[model samples]
Target: MSLDYLVAQPVLEAERFILRPVRKSDTGLISHYASDERVARMTTSIAHPLPPGAVDAFVARAMAEDRSEDVWVIDGTREGGAELKGIIGLKRMDRNQSEVGYWVAPPFWNTGLASDALQLLVGSNPLKNDTMFASVFQDNPASARVLTHCGFKYLGDAESFSVARDATVPTWTYSRKL
Candidate 1:
């Protein structure tokens, strides 16, 4: 990947938080939340007992000019909330499509932050994608609801490898036409 073909990530705003590109300063907070077993086990990535410097590497990739995915920190400092409430991203795919992924800090769970962030990202559609896709482990229905609430329809049941769980977990796939 090269800078010439990179698409600049845009800052998106919401009533409670703003979605902005990840920065070096976010490493600490991201590490703190992602380190939680409750948070790590739900996603396909983010290994449990996070390896040394994992967050640093993740942040570096996010800031890379030629990265395939666009990641944003769900910042809430504007509303006097936590500066890093969570993280969200869209991984580009062929055919003007992308895969959406996100996770909220355990402390912020049930606070509607995830839902707001998802809605904001979809509404912005920064990648100008024709469609978007997402999948959630069957055990995490909360995430599935967040997607459905934002207009993603259930596509089918599937499985994905979870780095944290170290197993192939059942997942529910969904997609929304833009």
Candidate 2:
């Protein structure tokens, strides 16, 4: 499943959630979850104490055709669940590859939501990537477990700047050959 079509935007379904393109209405929910200090610090981009309109800008960017990444809302409402449990995305990289990124709200932590979402995404191989890459802060062992449980092998150590932390954090990189 070459994700080339995703450039046109498509809805992907998982067992418990609907992964769809971001929507304007999601701003409030997104802002609410993203503003959590724990959530923001875990991500590369979101800042702690989220700025005004940050979610708005993010939604706008996700909806843009020229954007480098394809983002989706982890909508679980159809299952009688939260409207927004989290977010997942893929950033296009060179050589038929992409980087996977995701975060689940604190309420959903340890509930296997991340594992399910990631397994669904990787198993689908929507991007038709020969390989996929991911990284998690060393402090976030659960995230590292999510990748490993999905069969991603440890690649090495790396460092990435966390805007919310306002510092460089050690990361454990992983990759899978699809």
State every prediction's TM-score relative to the real structure: 0.96, 0.94
Point out the worst 10-residue segment of candidate 1 by lDDT: 1-10
lDDT per residue for candidate 2 within 20-135, as digits (tens), equals: 88888999999999999999999999998899988999998888877888888889987999999999998999999999999999999999999888888888777788999999
Q: Give the TM-score of candidate 2.
A: 0.94
* Model 1: per-residue Cα lDDT over 109-134, one tens digit each: 99888999999999999999999999
Off by over 4 Å in 2: 1-7
Lowest lDDT 10-residue stretch of candidate 2: 1-10
lDDT for each of the candidates?
0.94, 0.90
Best by lDDT: 1
- Best of the candidates, TM-score: 1
